[model samples]
Target chain A: AQSVSQHNHHVILSEAASLELGCNYSYGGTVNLFWYVQYPGQHLQLLLKYFSGDPLVKGIKGFEAEFIKSKFSFNLRKPSVQWSDTAEYFCAVNAPLRAGNNRKLIWGLGTSLAVNP
Target chain B: GEEVAQTPKHLVRGEGQKAKLYCAPIKGHSYVFWYQQVLKNEFKFLISFQNENVFDETGMPKERFSAKCLPNSPCSLEIQATKLEDSAVYFCASSQGTLGGQPQHFGDGTRLSIL
Candidate 1:
């Protein structure tokens, strides 16, 4: 079975501090990776995705993630985070599209991030 | 911006009552998905639809859960005889197509509480 794991359950950091959230997936085959963030009282929004090329991907709010195949990890990073960046983050994976059903996402237990100003 | 609309942001039901949730996918999106986020549990895929056809329902509980997507209308998920354990936030999402590498856009989830 394919599964995703997020190491941190909750993280606290001060404003302007660098942030890194760890994510790992257990899948033997090729997989598509994604990071999504949900602010308080808001919908889940895409932070970044890695489909095929470029392991290093940049996304909104100065957030970026690197997909390391050898490490089986896709860690989200930010040089500086703001208080507004406080939100829950989720990592997801989809198996390489085969023939039949390929639309479902396998999600990790979310990590709640709190950035204090 | 791509948007998926979900109705009844909050719902409360009795132990034996039924609960229903609705979702409308963005125009031109062919794939619709439903997920359940229970406390202390990871997000679980409930079902997926492709143009009113059931694509994958393996994650759904066949006994009490049912879903349908009517032509030219929003999709609906119905849970019969709700249990207290059924309490969770249900999310709806849509994507351009189910081919591959398509990121899904999610809607504000409907939080369901069963007493």
Candidate 2:
């Protein structure tokens, strides 16, 4: 069975601090990795996605993720975080070219980050 | 429409009552997916449809859960005799197509509370 793991469940940091949320998946085949953020009282929005090619992909709000196929990890990172960056971050993977028609995104448990202003 | 729309932001139902949720996918999207977020972080895939056709239903609790996506109408998920454990946020997402690595666009989930 394929599963996704997010290392941190809750993280608290001061504003302007660096951020790194670890994400790892168990699928051995090719996959599409994605980072989604959900702010308070808002829906999940795509932060970044890695299909192929470049290993490091940049997303909105100065967020980026590096896809390491060898480690099965697609960790989200931010150099300088803001107070508004406090939210729930989710990591999802979709393997559309796999065996079946089940194109569901296997999601992680999500990481809740709190940035103190 | 460019965003996935879900109606009735919140719903409350009795343990034995039935609960129905609706989702309108993006205008050009061909795939619609349903997921249930239980413990604020854990998400369980319920079902998915590809243009009114059931694409994947392995995750659904067939005995109590039912879903459909008909032409010219919003997709629906209904639970027969809802259980207390059915309380969760149901999220609907849509994508242009299933092929390749198309990113899914999600909607503000419908919070279902079964008392």
Best by TM-score: 2
List TM-score per model, in order: 0.96, 0.97
Error of 2 at B115 (Å): 0.5
Q: Output per-candidate TM-scores for chain A, rounded to 2 decimals.
A: 0.95, 0.94
Clashing pairs in 2: none
Candidate of highest lDDT: 2
Query: Lowest lDDT 10-mer window, candidate 2 chain B?
Result: B95-104
Model 2 alpha-carbon miss at residue A98, Å: 4.3
In candidate 2, chain A reaches a TM of 0.94
The DockQ scores of all candidates, in the order shown, are 0.68, 0.61
lDDT of 1 by residue, B77-99 (tens): 99999999999999999988655
Can you tell me which runs of candidate 2 are displaced by over 4 Å?
A96-102
Please tell me what DockQ candidate 1 reaches.
Answer: 0.68
